[model samples]
Target: MTILSYADSALSLLPPVVAIMMAIVTRRVLLSLGMGILLGAVLINDFSVIASGQYLGEQVAGLFWDDGAVNAWNMYLLGFLVLLGMITSLITVSGAASAFADWARNYIKCKRDAKLLTMFLGCVIFIDDYFNSLVVGSVARPLTDRYYVSRSKLAYILDSTAAPICVISPVSSWGAYIIALIGGILTAHGFTDSGHLSVFIQMIPMNFYAIFALLLLLCVIFWDLNVGPMRQHELNAQKGNLYDEAKGLPPGANSDLPEAKNGKILGLFLPIIVLVLATFYFMVSSGGDVLAADGKPFSILGAFEHTDVASSLFFGALVGFIATLALVLIQGLDKLYLTKGLVAGARSMLPAIYILLFAWTIAGVIGQLETGKYMASLASGNIPFALLPAVLFVLAGLTAFSTGTSWGTFGIMLPIAADMAMGTHTNMMLPMLAAVLAGAVFGDHCSPISDTTILSSTGANCHHIDHVITQLPYALIVAGISLGGYIVLGFTESLMAGLATCSILFVISILVLKFKSTQAIS
Candidate 1:
């Protein structure tokens, strides 16, 4: 029995705290996470670096095999991400990406249309947030560039729809994960009768942040609701500056993908369609069916609740990659040379993979240390039950924003949220659970260190920090509205009523801001 391995000690917070502080201070995410992992290992090994060194070595070895489900999930995600990159690279090489953009350009007569197209593409690719951001950016970046739409705005649009849509959509990787989390938690708590799928579906209506964020994004696109740093970015973009000329970004791919002299839009569109269909098949097949209260197959929701999304995502990406390669090969345009895009794609994704590896390692350490449980205990006392949903929302957002991961945040907070609900018997479980999801998405949306944020920058060919700076204010506006909505829901307990009230507030606020910004522009 290790002394503190499972203890809910405050010291458990040290690792993530160290990682966050160092990431912000040095702006070196990789080095910061490594330092945090080492620091955490030392503490866990009773302050002996040599012992911790051995432990680290063991963990490195075990990452691929120590636990079956954990290893499978990790491998699946890595496979999906790398394969997706390869697909992107393949499309770019085949001129399919360029052709698609050029083909779409006829529809984009103005900046508003360009932004809306980007937003539309983002919403349509809700299979995975990672896929959505990267693909939409690549496909729409050229179109947006033609209209002088700020790279920041493109990144914003790419990011805004990616996670928000996935969070709300019932058929996404995120949906499967959320249901699994709820199912697992309720099962653990002896509430075996509870249907995690049903609960998640119900919580959808209460996901204040996602609904508002999506609505806000559409308004921002159509109404030209530029504010804060975004306004200046848009103004500069109109003057032919895509990014701030005063600052130099770190060396990265400038995204000068060649426009294919001979390419087909079908080559690009068909693969994504295949990926979606394949993922859905894998999801339903993996997620076994159950009989409903009406004694019939519970349909897609039943499949979602049981689906193995990690595996589904991996296969989906793999299918898309293979389909893209075949499509290009059939065209005989690039010949054997185009195969190189596979390696190039995976290579391009290395930085993101490294970040994910380190971030996940620390999250694992945090789990071992029971840091989440510590947080729950620390924040539990003296709060009125009616206020818990809002508090949990705020806490979740802060945790996710600092750590830069909604999935990891879900791991840390979902259990706590479930336990608190059972312990308090506060019937606010639905909204509270919803709050955690919304907050996690909100925080991830806002964080500079987030993987999606980095990918958005890479996809849009914008500086990473620039994407973060321009997007944070928008995230905050929605987050603030979410907080207020949660507070109201805690008392009213009517999901539709709460959503109706918040939607009106969001539209009114956006209209007022839209008027002010447009006047300022005129």
Candidate 2:
């Protein structure tokens, strides 16, 4: 179909939005997303059964077999999910989580401290957002609950830190994606002569939203500023009715769930440490000349480039599996029970897998419709030079919110933003691209239907809707600060200034809220 025709038709259909709406209303995520994908395919092909079938076939093929899509599915989502499930299973089987909770109980002292610690741990696991969400939430939830820190707050901490931290960390999965896109943009814009290091460094300073958001989260933790919907939810949680009893246990109890014996914490910790070390080794080994082998320099990036995300995760999983087996054998636990733990771990990942598949399918349909290029075209003619960064940020945020996938949002926005930057003379390229990343994370951070949001809620044992409602106010506060930061960045030509401005605003906002709260109490 022609570009205009496709744009007009797809805009009218609004497949992604419609699909998500259906999922929310029906509370059947897979079914709603599936119908949405089918609708997009039919709409794209003019409702031709044969064409729709062909499109669907292509989507499946691309999702499972194509270089980019398949690699993303395997390396990032699938591997992360599998490892998360396995780790959780081992922790449960070993009673390590319960032990950790008990241990933490002595030190935490109060609900506020418990919440702060959860946020701290979330920041610590910056290797991957997906990993961060699952690990921190699972580990901290029970401890937080024992102190009466609401599950919704725990989920908020997880959701807030996951993408925000990942996007900025150079060694993270998010770092890899951003670097790859930046590399492409560099090549496209005649900046290849400056080299990748220079390009990455330039972008770092201009990543206003990312730097400021992290600062804002810290302020939120330290100042304990709760507002809007989150305040109401916290009040509800204080009343002991924050979640439905039918869903599961009280905020964090492992009651009625299997618990592992002593030393199971080692079973969980050892494997994860090994995985982190291995990931670093591999990332360095592949990067070209970052390491030495046999009196010669080696390329870690080169090796990492060839290795898929799934393979990297599999390496971690192997370590975890072996650790679990050894712990079981040494502890004299039944081998059958260990096997059962593995199965249980894999089973828990099923929900994440289904979500990944449907997300990929939706991304494919949108890509087929060439939505990115259409979006670029729309922005090309209208955006004022001064407003480019803010506009790009908002656009990226909207796309991620609509699709409920920050990675997918990144995939679409990076290329388009790159093109826009190139078209605009490369003067504001770094800030523009950084804005895209910042916006994607911002949207995903607050999106109720987002996968990270779901995983965080699951890990925290929080009601999903409760988590969404409670988290929204905090996310909006950060977003508002970020918007102002973007504006400063666009006008002042000093990214550092913009970041500093936003950070001050965030701290002031939190303090004002705290003072107001204290006054009300008096």
Candidate 3:
């Protein structure tokens, strides 16, 4: 098959649009993604049935096997999901989760405390979005459930905090990846005065959407700002219903698992602590290996830049699984019950795994179609200097939303934004780059197909579509505020002005929600 270019054409946009629309309308994610994948294959192969079939086969095969070997990244991620499911199941069956909830009830008195604790944990677990999304829910769910905090609300907090914190934290995987990209972009654009790390630090304040999203989540928790679909979820939670049971149990929840009467709280925290430590250890050690192979002295940042995240996560989860099993054995659980827990745990993760595989496959198909390239091309033309940052923000958001990957959006748009800024808005490079980062995160928050989004739902044990629908309004509000900030920054050429605008708008939005809640109460 010959390589074709959809880089310059709008046809590249069709697949994701069709997929997103179908997903929203029919609520069938796998089917929608499959349709999009097939459409992309047909279009990419110029409507040849044989070519399309072969291309689709190769794409799916390539996800698992690359260059005649296993695709370590995808396989490792799948492995981690399975291990996490088992850990969750083991924790529940061992009665660790129940004990922890009981222990927490002493310190956490109300629903507000439960939600705030969830948000706090979300911020604390900031190393990797996947880790944060999966771990925080497992830790906080019991407490939240004790207070009847809706599963959708928990999912929202997990989703909001996961990527936003990772994007801003210099020590996180997201930060390392973005900084590496920024380093290349800066070099390419003849910028040598500032280190990528310093530039990343400077851009933090300009990452308006990320900062605002976290703030919005805080306000939602503090002031009870459950607007849109989330309000219904909250009301139901207050009525002692965490979710619509008719929709069935969410992933990672196994009702068949038996709980031990004498389960210790240590059973819960021990494995989680081990998982976090082991993952961090593996990440750094793996990075050290890469640095040694390159003949470079080991540095924290250098190691992060070269770390094998997938392998690190898999090994960490594997270690955590061992810890969970040991705890169960320590409690004198029989082998039969242990086997039952393992089977139930693995069974619960199958739905999420299926959705994830299809999401990855469709993302690959969209990449082949050059969807991001087409979107980026639309913004390459001349634009008013005052609108450049805003344009880049919107463009980056659109790319990420359509393709469902923030990192992919960064790869496709960061260089373009860097070049455009250096060429036109020379002094506004940092703000422009920050806009791209903010936009990518904003888009990821709203994208139902995003891996982090799926994981958040799984971790919270919330229905995926319920999470998507309930979270959309909150994401949009912050996005709107961030867009306004970017537009102001572009026009005024002042970061402070933009920051002030966002801060004031956020406060006002919270107040408005408060007023509305008060009126509803009356």
Estimate TM-scores for all models.
0.84, 0.83, 0.98
| C-alpha lDDT values of all predictions | 0.76, 0.68, 0.90
Q: Kindly list the per-residue Cα lDDT of model 3 for residues 168-251, writing each as its tens digit.
A: 998889999999999988888888787989989999999999999998998889888888889899899989889888877777
Q: Which stretches of candidate 2 lie over 4 Å from their true place?
A: 1-13, 23-28, 49-72, 75-80, 193-195, 232-243, 246-255, 260-264, 282-307, 334-340, 415-425, 448-451, 458-466, 515-522
What are the per-residue Cα lDDT tens digits for candidate 2 across 233-259? 567677875555665543222334466
Off by over 4 Å in 1: 1-7, 65-70, 183-198, 232-259, 288-299, 335-340, 402-404, 411-415, 418-427, 448-463, 492-497, 500-508, 515-522
Ranking by lDDT: 3, 1, 2
Lowest-scoring 10 consecutive residues by lDDT in candidate 2? 248-257
Best by TM-score: 3
**Model 1 lDDT at residue 109:** 70
Which 10 successive residues of model 1 have the least lDDT summed? 249-258
Ranking by TM-score: 3, 1, 2
lDDT of 1 by residue, 275-321 (tens): 77887787777665333333556567667766677787788778878
